[model samples]
Target: MIELQMYINGEWKESSNHEKRPIVNPANGEVIAYAPEGTIKDAREAIDVARKTFDEGIWSDLPAVERASYLFKIAGKIEENQEELTRLETLDNGKTLREAGYDILDAAACFRYYAGLITKPDGQTYHVADPMQAMVVREPIGVCGLIVPWNYPLLMSVWKIAPALAAGNTIVFKPSEITPVTPKKLFEIMDEVGIPKGVANMVFGAGPVVGHEIAASSKVDMVSFTGGTKTGKHIMKMAADTMKKVSLELGGKSPNIIFADSDLETSVDYALFGIYSGAGQVCSAGSRILVEESVYDEFVNQFVERANEIKVGPGNDPDSEMGPLVSQQHLEKVLKYIEIGQQEGAKIAAGGNRIVSNGLETGYFVEPTVFVDVQQDMRIVQEEIFGPVVVIQKFKDEEEAIKLANDTDYGLAGAVFTNDGAKALRVIKKLRAGITWINAYHPTYNEAPWGGYKQSGIGRSLGTFGLEEFQEIKQININLQVEPIGWFANKNE
Candidate 1:
């Protein structure tokens, strides 16, 4: 019975014509909330607010320290309502409450990290002989359009909002329609915590409408996106019409390379969680496991056994290790990928088929799946399945392992496990990936920069690397001596 409206200029405004869409809980396929079927008119209004706020308001003109204080306020509000936010995220997105708890913590860390960078000078210079000329100056881009993916809505929101706001740009966020509830909560939080009107706005609808408008908007100076590769390409084309600055963290078919010199039992356990966490919906999920031939059988055997033990239930349940997919469509997509794996000659180790477990037959749930003896060229190996499906391949040696890991178009993330630090280092330098973990998986830190080196993404998303993305540089040549350039004036000076 809850009705959601677009948040524009700090007002909860109804859709222009009251057209609405039903947002269903993927867990039970029941309509949980009614979201606005937002349109071009809504996006335009949001952009107009952003433009006015950016050009005239204190939010866009204030010093970075002041802007960061506002962000800190938002972060504090998020903490105060952490339990409620976690429930909303789990109900809307079908991640376990445990996962939502982790996401809130991550969001808090991202906000704190960006808050600290607010006063960082963009670029510094060791001055040369130009005595009359000063150095570089930092400038903020105007308004930004941030499109967050469904898998990690709140976390991605923090990633986009923190840096852009820290750089003094207004934002219009378009969270995925499937996971719109948390953003609505964020809107409420922003207003409650005294964020200036028009500094932050949000809309809800399918991507073609609201998403297209943001990408093609004249006032939107940049588009930051995280989603699938194919859709990202379309977004790129749409944003290219205006040649807007674009940042994308696209899909990944990242590899987990487990060598014989490593701790097989522990490595395989981490690899299982790496691929199957969040139902393998992470952009950096280790979907492709490349095990050294020396211990391939032993490693995958234990991996499958441990994966079979994971418990799937309602995300709100305190002990559920996994939950349903975001929707039935995504479930079918993952199932089809599992079918393709079987057809492409990959062996199904265990749980390749869906299981309607006790008291949860109505939800869109897929069992934890593991594939064995997968080839490098298989569709299941190359393409991002984006579910709790693992495609395990066996490699002969270190060179072959690195070769298999880097074979895909994706270079988002990969891991190498080895007790031999020397060998791990040697292989690490050869793997083509943005984030490479040694002897572990999914070791992301708020302080370390994260992005893909290849088709996986376009920009970094954390620490100092993330802060600089929203800023543009303007070099200033100051005339220390105000002497007119007369005939006697030194030309060099």
Candidate 2:
């Protein structure tokens, strides 16, 4: 078994209390690793060191070009360990190795993309009233606190870390308690890239302790979190004590609307890819599918057939299309949602039970579930199951579809499938979501802006918006005239 340690101040260290937790493989409930259960004192030390590093200007004061070079090197390090990291992620997070490979590639791309953009001059100069000029410049926001989720693990960590480092800020990060193995690998790469002491620190423990302390740290200038809505809200409340900048990317019960005019075969394929990808653990999975009344029956039949064909088993299996959930707790949660769906009178059109066969009896496996005749108000449709479960509801027209899609409290992501380009565009405009796709689902890029409206999240990540999240804006005013008109007692010089 691998032994994991927290990376802080450029060193791998055990918790002060020597507390540790076993890292279990959800595929077979094996103890694959043991990670430090860092405490509040450990979290404070990481934050303090990051604060000192930022204040010392070791990282935050570097020239943009110099910082970009470091980021480029870090990206290269990630690329070199791509294969190893992919397997480790599959072993730790229970995602298919194929999916893990895609995420690592994207993580590398994110670092490179941010590295290329960080050097470009930010802020603008404007000519104002006579003999005066105004300039708005962006600067790093000092120390940052980053909390990553268990679902995407390393990818989410990279999403926060790349931009923060590229923007010239030091950070103290906290990985999810359940899946800390891949993050340890990430710190190993960060060390290989020679990131300075305290510039990038991490702690592994429970959210209420390590995560909360990071958010509540006065030394941290900003907090960026990716997780559930409840935790995001609590982070907001805690960060408010210090008035720190907060950027959150939270949960989603996204809607995937399919019209009758859409390509039938293509729509069915996208729907399956939408929810079943990542075992439906993706935050932006289109869990609530709304199909037109004319083609509801046909679409449901083919979609069920496709879901049934999915090979669910250990992630390492080359033929396995869907892997086990991340843990036994999460598996139980998904199974409970399936029961709730049936209790609400929704018909199960596809698999909806625990998979206990083919040497998978001990694994946390739930078959991909599809529900039909689901009402918009049903808990199964409204709540985020975050599993391989999907709910299909019929819509009479575009108007009803829009209403149903916008019904949820979440406005993170949604997709529309139709042949008419104009109709697709129209539907896209009406959908109350931050990210919308015409015929595709869950295709996110490092070059584009991502986040959500309403409860789904606050602020945006990726693209220029993501870089700006770790930045603080300052406006500078210059007076060309040697003498200034006196507006107050000491106005004239």
The candidate that achieves the highest lDDT relative to the unseen native structure: 2
Q: Which residue ranges in model 2 land beyond 4 Å of their true spot? A: 488-493
> lDDT per model, in order?
0.87, 0.92
Model 1's TM-score against the true structure: 0.96
Against the true structure, what is each candidate's TM-score?
0.96, 0.98
**Inter-residue clash pairs, candidate 1:** none
Question: Weakest 10 consecutive residues, lDDT, candidate 2?
Answer: 484-493
- Give candidate 2's TM-score: 0.98
Native-structure RMSD, model 1: 2.3
lDDT of 2: 0.92
Per-residue alpha-carbon lDDT of model 2 for 1-493, expressed as tens digits? 9979999999999998998899999899999998988999999999999999999999988888888898898889889999998999999999998999999999999999999999887889997867888999999999999999999889999999999999989999999999998889989988987888889999999999999899998898999999899899999999999999999999899999999999999999999999998999999999999999999999999999989999998888878899999999999999999999899899999999999989999999999999998887899988889999999999999999999999988999999999999989999999889999999998999989999988999999999999999999999988888695766787354
Runs in model 1 deviating more than 4 A are 121-123, 486-493
Question: How many residue pairs collide in each prediction?
Answer: 0, 0
Best by TM-score: 2
